[model samples]
Target: MAQAQDMIRLQDVTFAYEYGDPVLEGVSFCIPEGESRVIMGQSGSGKSTILKLLLGLYKPISGEVYIDDEPIGPCSEQHLGDVRKKMGMVFQDGALFDSLTVGENVGFYLIEHENLTIEEVEERVRQVLKVVRLEESLIDKMPEELSGGMQRRVAIARALLATAPKIMLYDEPTTGLDPESATQVLRLMHQLTRERNIATIVVTHQFLDALAIADKFILIDKGVVAFDGSLADLKDSEDKRVTSFLEPFRASLRLMEERRFV
Candidate 1:
């Protein structure tokens, strides 16, 4: 049974692509409400797969997936849709509509799904943009007019405008940006989790961003959980695979420090 605070739980989940070998095996984890969970691993290690499973985009071949404590693996499309309402996803590229104005992109969901008039949707867009620390003035601008970090925040604002989602899933939210831009994105994510009490699952290969916002760290390797614990626990892990995965991050940090002295 899931506790009241448990917002997402996966129990012994096993899954594979059609006619492909298993990508996840006997994986299990719980994400409590208001927690920041970081899923980190090398490419094709099932980190993003976990996010897909949570969103009901893919069902497990074995075991159960619970969203808000409701089992969704066997639910109907309508049921899954309902479950998705409480969840929002920020994709790797921000996934904004270039054709639409920032305001249109932010309010697109409400404009299409809800019965709200244009004025109401615009108001909702204004509120969510505020939550993401974006100005109302930028609403009329196109996505291309903003920096990479601001575009990501607009995507987040779009997600928040509709149901004020209790859960936020981010897939490589800070990839392909300057260090300053990446830090800005990470800070925005951390602020949102703290202010809104939103549960977050971030899939990334970037260690610095993970270190910035993660309360819990999960490392997946070769389709299984290699480590799962608090940030301190992760740093303390003696597991060879964990150590191996962290080598590059350590090297990067050392290089940064060395350059500071030079």
Candidate 2:
């Protein structure tokens, strides 16, 4: 077993956008390395805010965001840059460059930040693609040419590059995917967390997206920590917020059960 610490954390975090109402109020959570946490909530319930706080893209009003036990305070961009290298964030839309090929997208960080040669960058790109199970032949293919699911995988591959990040953050990873594609992406998320031993946090309002990966589950309601526990705890909770958010999962299961009888 890996030695686990609070690899990612938000302590008493309160945040809001400019001239806006607070999105997170007194929010607190910790995730250990080599574990996965699924952060669930209704839309606009501050799920994505937690991710941005951790990345230090947004400052909390009254608390701290930590990565690898280091607090992300008001630090220099150079310092933040180094801290961020230890984390990989995947956006909801895949976030690939439009004009860049798959390989170019994957190798972009190295190309911009490192002194690696073209051959070295290309080689590293191919290797990470393999980690995400993308074909090497897709290297030169444009992002527009790939399926949505494949694009997600490509995004994951890009995140895997530079160095294997200690923390991996996914925002609405399975939102727009079909059930089959969603499952594939979710499974790959689970596979990579185990194989790479990354501390994973997924933010999604969709219950089904979280069904496949998570060592712990956290539900945020109205900018506060509503519930945090194992799957069993989630199922057993009497909290109306948790239950309402889980209705989709329950409905999905009921549908599956009905189908089995057919």
Candidate 3:
């Protein structure tokens, strides 16, 4: 049974693509309310697969997935939709609509799902945009008119519009940005987690960014969890797989230090 504080839980879940080998095997993890988990792995290592499973985009072949302590494997589409309403997802790309104004994009879900007047939706949009530190003036501009960081912030705002999500799933939220821009996005994520008490799961290869927002760390290797613990444990891990996965980051930092003294 899930405790009241547990917002997301997966118990011995397994999944595979159609006609493909297993992508996940006997995986289990839990994220409590107001906490953040970072999932890191190489390409095709089932990092994003975990996010999909949580969203019910892909159901597990075996075991159970629980959202807000409710089992989702047997849920109907309508029920899944209800579960999804408590969650928000930000994709690798901002995934904003180029055709819509920033305001329209931010308030899109509320307009479609809730019985809010245009004025009400616009007010709510402004509030979320403020949370992302975006100005109200950008609301009238098209997506193409904004910078990449602005677009990503807009995406975050959009995700928060419908309801105050209990969970936020970010798939490489800081990908394809300058370090400064990436830091800005990471800071926003940190702020949201702290201020809104939202449980967050970030799937990314960005080691530094992941460290910045993660309260717990998970490293997946070949469809299984290779390591799962606090960031301190990750740094101290002497496991072969963990060491091998971290070697590149360690080398990069060493090179930076060498260059600094040169």
Candidate 4:
């Protein structure tokens, strides 16, 4: 069952790789259960760092981090593990094992977490592959034998294999796909989140991807939040910086739509 309040909360959190250098300064946000949030920023804007903090991979020098209102601490290994069991993450590189086949990769979590038999795992793998629109025969293929888009779908299938109420943390999910593949992945992300009511945080530079699936959006600039609101608020803002960031992409998306009609 889902919790009643925000799934994640960060309050006045600050961090740095070294002394007197700050990467995130007093960053704060609340991600409510079932909300799909997009974290947007240019390179080095600490968007990924926020994900890391939430995952308990990074510790803040000051302030607090919470998952389901339970304070997160780097030292709380057992507690953190329990909390993380409710979440799934997809990395920018897909992060599949080079030696493991697709079926082995998707079945990994089930093997580790559930005492189910091989037959059960195989059945679950097939169901998840169908969710990602991949054929059962492809499960035996090596990761290198698949196309980039196929590899990504395999990764997403693996992420969804867990039956827990999972919150997906996606880092640059569409980085290298072609236009069609990127659009397909974006649509799939939307479909999964809506159908499952899963909480999702997508970290991306692609405004278009965020626009496609986000219930709300937040912008980080130079380690601090620059904007946080709905999509309409972002588009209608008179802020020159926001306009400059959005206008070029808006024009490009319009052109892409026009070309599709011709």
Candidate 5:
């Protein structure tokens, strides 16, 4: 069911590749404002496909994909870019430009698409990097010089700087980070959602840390929403598919039943 305040919506959205079977069928979900929705599933379970649809990179074969009440699925490419300005995407691999400095990567969009000067772009870049807790001095550093967690934070800074997006789409945002770094990233995500009132959609398979911060969880199984609800609802679920997926997350929960978590 869609909500009145949903920043992103997919209503009965169905899609398929050329000459391929359906990747997603009748998928419906919503991410309301100021909420963090984590999407988890096995590889190739249509998780990333949903992100692409939301980005207007691929139009669904049927139904609609709406962002900010705008049906972007059928919008023209010229118009799509305008609609896309309301959202930002963080790829799984921190898709930074290896050749460019952190500042260049973060300011690339505004530099190319907008008429901003170097000083204006740099100001915006500094602001967003600070929001991501990065030093302004690192602006000139290349992506290769940064650690994995630093690179991810840079990627997030780039996303946040892009048009001050109302909705954030993260594809494996915390992958390949050390445990401490991953926890920091998850906590930052939670902070961003609550403090900035951004609608966040995170697609990740490793969701133990995510469980600690996410407001809702959606498990996609075999191209369908196998489960969608709060953590309590998830724990109470009797569905075998849901329970099977929860096994690992539940195990981590039991490890430290004594001390209070930070």
Candidate 6:
């Protein structure tokens, strides 16, 4: 196993849009290399804010964000750009250009950063698409031609094209899919983390998404971390708030048992 000290680290990071209050307060955590962590929270709980902070899109008010132990605040623009190349992020909506075909979307990064010939870029795009189980025929299809699930798979394929070994940040990956499709996305995420040996952090509100994968899970509430542990530990937590939040889940299970024919 990789050493725990050298993965992604956040040191007392805090951020806020205005001076009224902080969105993330003294948040700190370390994700070991190749581990999958799910950051869960209700609305306004700062899950997405953490993603923004790590991406260096927003600066922390007090502390620092680090990838592979390099501090990530106020760095030179060129240095920050270099650091960003080591990471890949997928947004909630997949963020594909409406005009671009699936292959074009996946190859966009290579077109921008690499001096590879067209054949080389196409080969790389094909390789990553296979990782996401997208067929070659889908390459010519535009984003509008694919279903919601297919679009998300395309987004994942785009991220894998970066070939970054350290980190992949996913923001609400299972937001808009049917049950089976959502489960497929979650399982794919688990497989990708293991296969790529990359540190994966997912910020999501979907409890099912958390249960489907997540080697380590943390709960964010009211701008603070309320819990962090394995899924079994979360299921057994005695905290009233945690129990209250999970009550409906349990109740639904009992109802299912009572009405099996339904």
Question: For residues 5-94, what per-residue lDDT tens digits would candidate 1 score against the true structure?
Answer: 888899999999899999999999899888888898889999888889998999899999998888998899998888999998999999
| Model 4 lDDT per residue over 131-184, tens place | 988899998999999888888888888888864555788999999988778777
Query: How does each model score on lDDT?
Result: 0.86, 0.85, 0.88, 0.81, 0.86, 0.81
Candidate 4 vs. true structure, TM-score: 0.89
Predicted structure 5: lDDT: 0.86
- Highest-lDDT candidate: 3
Better of 2 and 3 by TM-score: 3
Pairs with steric clashes in candidate 5: none
Tens digit per residue, CA lDDT, model 3, 1-262: 5688888999999999999999999998899988889999889999889999999999999989999888999999988988999998999999999999999999999999889899999999988888899989899999999888889999999988865799999999999988778878888888888778899999998886676678888999999999999866887899999999988787564343332210
| Consecutive 10-residue window with the lowest summed lDDT within model 5 | 253-262
Q: Count the backbone clashes (under 3 Å) in each candidate.
A: 0, 0, 0, 0, 0, 0
Name the regions of candidate 1 deviating beyond 4 angstroms: 251-262
Candidate 4 worst ten-residue window by lDDT: 253-262
The regions of model 3 sitting more than 4 angstroms off are: 251-262
Clashing pairs in 6: none
- In angstroms, the error of model 6 at 159 is 1.2
Badly placed stretches (over 4 Å) of model 5 are 255-262
TM-score of each: 0.94, 0.92, 0.94, 0.89, 0.94, 0.91
Query: On residues 204-256, what C-alpha lDDT tens digit does candidate 2 reach at each position?
Result: 87665565677888999999999999877888888999888777687574444
